[model samples]
Target chain A: MTTIDYRLIDSTLRDGSHAISHQYYAEDVIRIVKGLDAAGVQVIEIAHGDGLGGSSFNYGFSAVPEKELIAAACDVTDQAKIACLLLPGIGIVDDLREVGALGVKVARIATHCTEADISEQHIKAAKELGMEAIGFLMMAHMNSPEGLVEQALLMQSYGADTLYIADSAGAMTTEDVRRRVNALVSALEIPVGVHAHNNLSMAVANSIAAYEEGAVNLDGTSAGLGAGAGNCPTEILAAVSTKYGINTGVDPLKLMDLAEEIVRPMMPRQQVIDRAGLILGYAGVYGSFLLHSQRAAERYGVSQAEILLELGRRKVVGGQEDMIIDVALELARKHAEQEV
Target chain B: MRCAIIGSGNIGTDLMIKMLRSEVLELVALVGIDPQSDGLARARSLGVQGPHEGPQWVLDHASEIDMIFDATSAYVHVRHYKQYAEAGIVAVDLTPAARGPKVIAAVNLEEHLNSPNINMVTCGGQATTPMVYAVRRAIETLPYAEMVSTIASKSAGPGTRQNIDEFTKTTSQALREIGGAETSKAIIVLNPAEPPIMMRNTVFAALPEGSDHSAVIESIYAMEKTVQSYVPGYHLKNRPVIEAGPFKTPGGDVPHRAVVLLEVEGAGDYLPAYAGNLDIMTAAAMKVGEAVAASRVSEARL
Candidate 1:
């Protein structure tokens, strides 16, 4: 068997915020950051569920401003590098500069799979600020391998230190992961990574497939605590990597302790492959949209499944939360027509 | 009543189609820098003069054209507006240049008809501002509003893609200035779906606590009627969805809020029916153009 070498990036404080409606207090940040750091994780990302400046009624508001959380995490962490995600329009360049000042070492500049052009200014700004810039092509399943490569090239051109194929919906199968990652690994001059969701219950397997296919960076959160069915559970991925003899430098036992004793208990709700979660993966809707869709479904008296399916049919992506209400309302209207 | 379209891209072409179907106006020229543009080609096939030289063609043929619809881009519209204004012609801008008073046909079209140049804030602004204005008219004390516009990726032309920042800025400004909110923000999403989706807008307004939901809903439905009179494809996807606040506003927490969902279907003029973003602009512009043409005829008769 080939010797495996990869990096485990913990997102318990970032993507995990979605599962809790982005209500991450400073204490939660410090505890999660200190735990992940001591576990020998290479990188820890902390931000609102939708990234920096993503605190509004549109996306849920963070309990405290992200800067305070970032500062708390930075102050506690000594081993792992601190990072954050920035989804261009939602988080401006000034937000990036502010986080960098708060000791964020890496800036993951993200955009929709086809909209990589919009990330240019943010990525360039991060680089100019002397930060390691990672380009995140979200909703990776939306584009073909060739299309992904073309968009990745645009990011690589703009000085992205690494490019991540972020499966925002957790919809890709292991084979799908391998194909897209292999294509990006071959096409990109920089290292390639994968940020997988567990909506389809494939996050760990898909992350493993991506690693085998040449993705050097893999992302996960504690107890699979994230959007939809949550992310690749960091502890489980660590254990699985050990079984495969991959050296992620992350302590599986510590991750397990953190996931069980600390993370799981704090979760507002358990992350499970419930009907709506599975439908998010099946329909290829965004993971962050799960809670919003559920609330909208309740508000409009429509099935969350119907909302997810229609959203998937429309290809509604991240940053299009408003489309959920539109979908739910349409379903309700159609139901009303039938009743009449 | 003689008019010209000043861009040959998706919007300009669609506008040309609407112009061709206009009863009160004559389309004298289709103007664009690209000689081989499909819009200009369509213009030539229909025996309307197609000019590759752009606004100068409209200038050279100034006597034949009374109005010019600038649909090129925000940056290009800057120069087109200046030239058209200097040439003593009426300019209707479809870009987010915001060089003149932003006009929503349903809310304040007649007010800007006499202005030398009128700016259509953006497709999102057009679809959203009317609802915001209606809410403001009903509540009269709205402090915050935010709009989210989702359009089909296929329908967004190069101009729309490049002007996204301006789209947000222009639309947000209109949401506050013309929509009459104390503060506002805008978001635009281009969905890459096969069998493209129609244009959709969500307008969120935070009214003071204990505001009358029925009054705001009634005003919004009435405003929808006004917009649909000219842009027939415009309609509410559902009745207004109102939620009591504890909602977040830029200023602080607010009391009650109203959320309006609007969908726009195209008239299948030059693009597909899903291209309502383009259709709404053209349809609204035609309504304004007809008003302008009527006034010109009245003056001529006088």
Candidate 2:
């Protein structure tokens, strides 16, 4: 029996802080966490920005750090569980323990397929402190099937209660998402989770794929705040999940309200989800969109903005930066010489 | 000492051959759900074991292997992780279906050889991260360092496009991890044409007043050597492409372009490489091999 009701893992203070330079005031973090809590998101990931050190963590949106952010986040309403992501090497282990002691219920150790050991250490340490531990594999796009299994099993062994299918790069297709999540679920009996990015416009599809493959938890931010293309829209997923008869406990209206209220007040609408970002999302180039765009622009003598537009217009796929550059150079010379 | 491969994908096949050549690893069987798996056939031709259907085959042949490479995909990887663990098999993952270890064979070699789950960040990470890290190390002395890396779409290859929609995030994350900076990231753009675009990555670092921008640029070139030893595809081109003018796109659009931009500390601009493009893929496989083996998987595992 595949059931559908879901839980939302709101990563605003956790992931959104990445773009804002990890400078969200603890009170602002508390505000967003409480907002998501009121909206009924099951999990509020508080201070985990890309699973790295809290050194990037600041006190507020103005780029200050207040000891109160973590403390205030724990004050979340009864319905929400507080979560934090720590990149094993970047995060100070003792600090992780302290955060747990400070009322963080879940500690997520983030790692790559190759650095599973670091995640193991973090998760193992978190468990020793009596916290719910999970392992987050960033950039799922780069993994092979066997690699996925290897990482998940290690996470389970290292004291992780849950394992997340994190598409850190947001470069995964629903099919790709489904295949990997299915493998993970079949191989590991522990609860499985899915985190999607809006790159390629499949965040929702990929999230569903994970759910279809038996992923119980889905990670989302209010309006997809993240490093590159951002993450899957929280309200959209909650709406769709509820429509499918799976309860995502998230109140669609409240989720929308949280996006408009707590988020829009801070970020521009275009910034939250832009056309360039959408193109990257549709192209499945989530985290790397900006990288490719900015770099390609300089190499090919174009603005990062124009290159991304061209890439999107052409439905371009991976490893073609040189071709674009070459073409751009040729076009540029011709344009300058008025030969075209 | 021994590792089993369970997928016939690009990474699965590539890694299999690499492992076979390594003095530290014993390449066992290859498993595939598809009979048409090119990797399976390649392994089979080399006299490797089954393109078997599922985990049962691995269970049946458990005695023959020690570690498993689940190169299949995500959903499949999720299920297989449990199987390998229960069967007492140490698993080395190449996919990111879950919170798997992030392994850059060279950067995180020791961790993988010692731990059961070793995840390569991805092809893009392999191609770009080390360079980013190298640059990061160089720039830490500067005030507020920020580097921008860019990658072409085609270099990512086919498997990367399965989610053809989610690459930006993947590309961004891949670079950040590799660079190891207080703040470093990348942007990826795809150029879809009859012929695909070559993979290109650029590192832009802000130097604080007279910070030897030329040296910074030179350091980038030097990093190329480290990558070249492994990725044969990486090569520097000859003289810059003569200014032939704008070229027409397949759609008949004209755009101005140049080969490469070399920003020396004081120099306004320099054409770094115009005649040749770097083949990161070829280098990627080699680089991954070095990273994973540097730790010597067997010694660390044991």
Candidate 3:
């Protein structure tokens, strides 16, 4: 058997911000960055969950402005390269320059799966800034493998060093992950990565499947403390990779300690495949919509599942969180009319 | 009044088709770098001069044209606007370059009529800013406003893709400067659904408590009618809805929130109906062009 190796890019601070409503502070960043760096993670990503400049009314505001937290993380990390995600429209090139100055080495330029063309300027900007540019296609399940390749190639043309297929909704199964990863690995000259959400309780399985299919970059959040149900648990992936004889180059014991002792205690709620989270996967809704939908559901006195299912039907993509309240109101009005 | 269109992409082609039907403005030339572009080809077929020489083509024939519609990228527009101004031709910029004062047809076209250059902010801006202006006009004070524009992915050309940042920034600024909000934000989404969807915009306004809700709704409908007069496909997706607040905003919580949903369907001139995003831009530009032409014609008569 060929020894399989992968670079784990832990997104506990970035995606996990969605789980905690973008409230990570300096102390939290210091503790998590130290733990992940000691665990031998290759890259540690920290940013607002919606990416840089995402601290706004549309996306929740970060408690400590992300730059301060990013600076704190960079100060603490010994070996792992500090990274930040920048969604082109939400976060601009100026934000990239600001973060890069603060020691962010990787710029994960993200776009909707089919809108990679929009990332051209940002990716080029990152490359010009001398940061490693990664093209991140979010909600990968929305586009076919063939369609995604076409979009991925656009990013590659813009000088992206690596490409990522993010199952942001955690909607993909093992087969889905394998096929997409295999297709990307086959078509692109650069390496492929996978950012999985645990909405369907498939993050660990999907991450393993991506590795089996030539994806070298995998993402995990400590204890799966991320958006929706959470992300692939870093400790769980390390333990499972060791059992499968895969060489992930991380200390499983250290990761387990981080998850149990450091990260787990900070989580607002335990990451679980709750009904709303499951609906996010089943309906192919964006994972970050979980909290927004839950809040809308409660305010309007409607079922969270109904809201998620309707949002899916409308095909609401990321950055459409405002639609949650619109959907809830529509559902509430219909229920009121029916009751009358 | 004679006018030429530079940059023969989807926007230029659609503007050409609309211009061919215009009584106020004569379509003189469609200019592009590529002779093989479909827009240039269609221009020739319509008996208009189709030149493959880029902006120089328009400059060479500057005396024959009264106005130039720049449908090119923002960077290209920034380079061309000064030359157009030097040639004594009025430029109606379709890019997000914002080199000149921004003009929304229904709201501010008349304000910048005599200016040598006018900027049509962006497609998203054209669709939503007027609605923002309407709400502000009704309530007299709007604390905050934000807009989300979702258009079909296929409708976004290289110009739109390259200008995504400008789209958000310009549109956000328009919401404040033109839409009359103290603080604002703008977001754009490209949906790649197989059967393309029509352009939809959601405009959210945070109002102070005790503001007149009915007046706001009436104002929005009035503005919808004004926009529909030029772009017939523009209309309200629903009656504007107002909900109790403290609605959360980046600035802080506000007392009331008003939501307006708008849908724009294309006239299907040169582009498909699903490309209403492009259509509204061309339509709004045509409206501005005609107004400018009418002003020029009147000035010549004087």
Candidate 4:
């Protein structure tokens, strides 16, 4: 086994935003950031679930402004750099300028796998502001390895420091992770990262595969508190890394305390591979759409799994939560008509 | 009327095929910067004048063209729009440059057809704005409207990918301008599904308390007919869904809101049937171009 030097990016504040319906208070940020920083996590992303400027009625508005949340995170973090995700359409270049002024150190400009070219301006803006720009090709399971590498090349050319394969759906298997990560690692000079969801309970296994295939950065949230079945749990990941004799620069014991004592107790809902989550992984639907799908399903009196399946059939990505309600409504109407 | 297409991308090439079937308009030239672009290659094979010099090609054959479809990127459309305006050419812009008044064929095409330059907004705008306009026409006021358009990832060309920010901005602004929404937000999704799916749009609008639900649904169906007149593939996947009581929106709480779902299948012009996003733009442009052509022909006859 090749030795891996991996870095953990704790996203309890970013992906975790989805679990909380984008209601992360400043106090939540301060505690989480401080805890993760002390536990030796190198990067912590803070923003709305969908990214900065994603606070709207359409995609649950954050209780507090993201800038304020970032400021709170910045105040607490002494070692870990503050990072934020920025989707091109949902979060524009102006959001980057605001985050840069808030002392954000890293900017992850994300786009749909085939839409990486949309991230060009945001990546350039992040680099111009002297931030470590990371290119995030979200919904990695949606694309082939070769197709992903081509998109990653666009981000690299636009000045991304690192490229991440974000299995936003938690859909990839270990082999899927290895193939894409290895291909991207070989094709691009920049380091590759993995952001896996635990929908199919494969987030940890996928992360390990990514590390084995030369991915240097991996994202996790304490207690797997994130969208869908949550993300790779930081404490579990650190413990697993120790088992593999890998140096992740994170203390397993400290991470366990953060996950068990700090994060899990405050979770709105325990992260589990429920029917909807399993369907998210199985159907390759984006995990971030989990809550919205659930809410829509309930509103339309349809099964959440059915909603996920329909959304997956439609190949809906992030920023398409509106599709969930639409699909649910249509399904409910069809059911009514069929009953008649 | 003799018309040229200024960009030979997915949208431009599709527009070229539609124009080739036009009853009134003559497709004069297909222009692009890439000599090897598939659009220009296809245009050449179809016996259309395919030139790679873009606006310069139109300028070289200035007398032969009366109107031009600017299907290039937003930044490129800005330059092409100015050049076309100077040469007294009517330009239909498919980019989100938003340099001219926005026109949706089902809503305000007649009002803006006489303008020298007309902006088609974005595909999302073309797909959702008409529904919002229909709601507004029925209720007379839409406090808030949010639109999300999901298209196949393979259907979005590089130009579409690069213009993501502009698309949201332009589409949302057009919702307010043409759709009569007091507050509007727009989102786009590029789905990377294999055997790519058709284009789908969701429009959410907050209505006044105890509004006429049947009247609004009737209005929406009527608007769907108008759009179908130009875009044969546009249809409602289901009847409009209405929800009651204190709905939360960015614009604030509303007592009632109507949810509309629309899907557009392509005409299978240049791209496949999954590329309805591109087809809608070409179809709307053709509608405007045909109007321009009819008016020009009548003037020449007189």
lDDT of 3 by residue, A5-107 (tens): 9999999999999999998889999999999999899899999999998876567667888999999999999999999999987888889999999999999
Worst lDDT run of 10 residues, candidate 2 chain B, spans: B263-272
Which prediction has more favorable lDDT, 1 or 2? 1
Q: What is the DockQ of candidate 3?
A: 0.49
Candidate 2 stretches with Cα past 4 Å from truth are A1-4, A19-23, A54-62, A65-68, A75-79, A92-95, A271-275, A278-340, B1-302
Off by over 4 Å in 1: A1-4, A37-42, A67-82, A88-105, A115-132, A300-302, A330-340, B1-3, B23-28, B54-67, B78-90, B112-116, B289-302
Clashing pairs in 4: none
Docking quality tier of candidate 1?
acceptable
Q: Write the per-residue lDDT of candidate 1 for residues B1-302, one digit (tens) a residue.
A: 88888988899888888788788988888788998888889889988888899878888888777898899999888866887888889998999999988898888877877889899889889999999999999985888888888888888887876676678788989999899999887877777777788998889888887678899999999999999888899998877888754766774678777889889999998998999999898888888888878877887899
Q: Please report how far candidate 1 places residue A18 from its true position, in Å.
A: 1.2
lDDT of 3 at B225: 92
lDDT of 1 by residue, A150-216 (tens): 9999999999999998999989999899999999999889999999999889999999999999999
Q: DockQ (C-alpha) of model 1?
A: 0.35
| Higher-ranked by TM-score: 2 or 3 | 3
Q: Give the TM-scores of the predictions, in the order they appear.
A: 0.89, 0.51, 0.94, 0.92
| Model 3: CA > 4 A from native | A1-4, A336-340, B138-141, B208-218, B243-248, B253-255
Index of the highest-TM-score prediction: 3
What lDDT would each prediction earn against the true structure?
0.87, 0.58, 0.90, 0.88
Chain A fold similarity by TM-score, each prediction = 0.98, 0.80, 0.98, 0.98
Please state what fraction of the native interface contacts candidate 3 reproduces: 0.46
